[model samples]
Target: MGAGHGHRLHYHGHSRLHRAPAHLKLVALVGFMLVVVATPRELYPVFGGYALLLVAVIASTGVPFGYIGKRMVVEVPFVLFAVLMPFVATGPRTEVLGLSLSEPGLLAAWGLLAKATIGVAASLTLAATTEPLDLLRGLQRLRVPDLIVQIMAFMVRYLDVVTAEMGRMLTGMRSRGCDPRSPRHWPLLARSVGALFIRSYERGERVHLAMLSRGYDGTFRL
Candidate 1:
């Protein structure tokens, strides 16, 4: 009913950050995430510092706040699960706000939330600012096996095609009064899943045949 989301990454004005080599940027991003993920959960100050650091980087990129906020929605499930820990976790039970809260558990929950938020923010920033081609080039430079890089490149390239095909198949079923949401549709759901598998297999075979006709080999030469 409205404009769809953009999967392709875009570049913006020439900035110092944009001028940096992809490999170096990727390494720094990875390291930052690891630090946030590994830090002790009870260390709120450390987490706050990490969050501020990420905010600084995000500000440096000049990306819109709305974009980062929208992407952070991806962390909701993790945050919810972390929220549940305080109630179920075994530890010194303390009453807070007229509810039983595990002291250690509260710390654990906050830790997970902080880490997840920081991690998502970092990933979103990297993804929003860098082009996929540059990301692949970075991977290649980092000694990621050539074959793996090629597979990733192809997957990213064809992901839209595959998703569209699957969506069409789902739509056809829906049009025929097949309600996937209903519990009684389990059998139909299973069949549809099986059909999807067959379709994917056939698609792969046809693609292989086409590649063979073009004198292709197992190795994907860049």
Candidate 2:
């Protein structure tokens, strides 16, 4: 993949995975996830096999497990939802650790967690090895909608900018002795978010105008 944007998830490397075609990696990712989703929840050992495949790919990429582990926090919500399944879902009960959990729900929870973890890991692996611009170009190669691809391209390009803006806003709030996370100051936080959105929208307009001035033709040329 040709270098373009510096991404937090992208590891700078010259490994074979980094050298692989982005469109092919995207295809393989889709295919791998399909197999994972299709597998029966009761086939516990098979899920382990899927995990081993991911581990092997990850190892070959030369990216540290710790580097990948940090980004795995994105899956916390899925983990939480999976943990609640056995407690709330309707099914025959089984006692384990002195707590009664629904038998079927346990299986469902395992399947959900396993699939979600594998999917996220696979995606992060791709992100670590492929440049953001290359990934977008790959989507274009796969015939995804031009408009959607354009949106994704812009989002990836400007994500760090938006994040920096948010950080500044939070710092400004703190300097004013306002707690952004506290319930009492939530109104201030809400207004800050609205203000941020308007600012970002205006910035986008200016960027579009600048691009048009430079003879941008709607399609990304690389």
C-alpha TM-score for every candidate:
0.82, 0.88
On lDDT, the candidate that comes out on top is 2
Tens digits of lDDT, candidate 2, 1-222 = 223457889998989999999999999999999999999988999999999999999999899999999999999999999999999989799999999999888988998999999999999999999999999989999999988998998899788888789888899878988767769888888888899999999999999999999999777675
Best by TM-score: 2
Runs in model 1 with CA error above 4 Å? 1-13, 173-198
The Cα error of candidate 1 at residue 160, in Å, is 1.0
lDDT of each: 0.80, 0.91
Cand. 2 TM to true fold: 0.88
Give the per-residue lDDT digits (tens) of candidate 1, residues 1-222: 123444544436355666678898899999988777788887778878887888888788887777788767889999889989999999899998899999888888888888788888888888778777788899999999998998788777767777777788789988988758878888877887788778877887898899999989787765
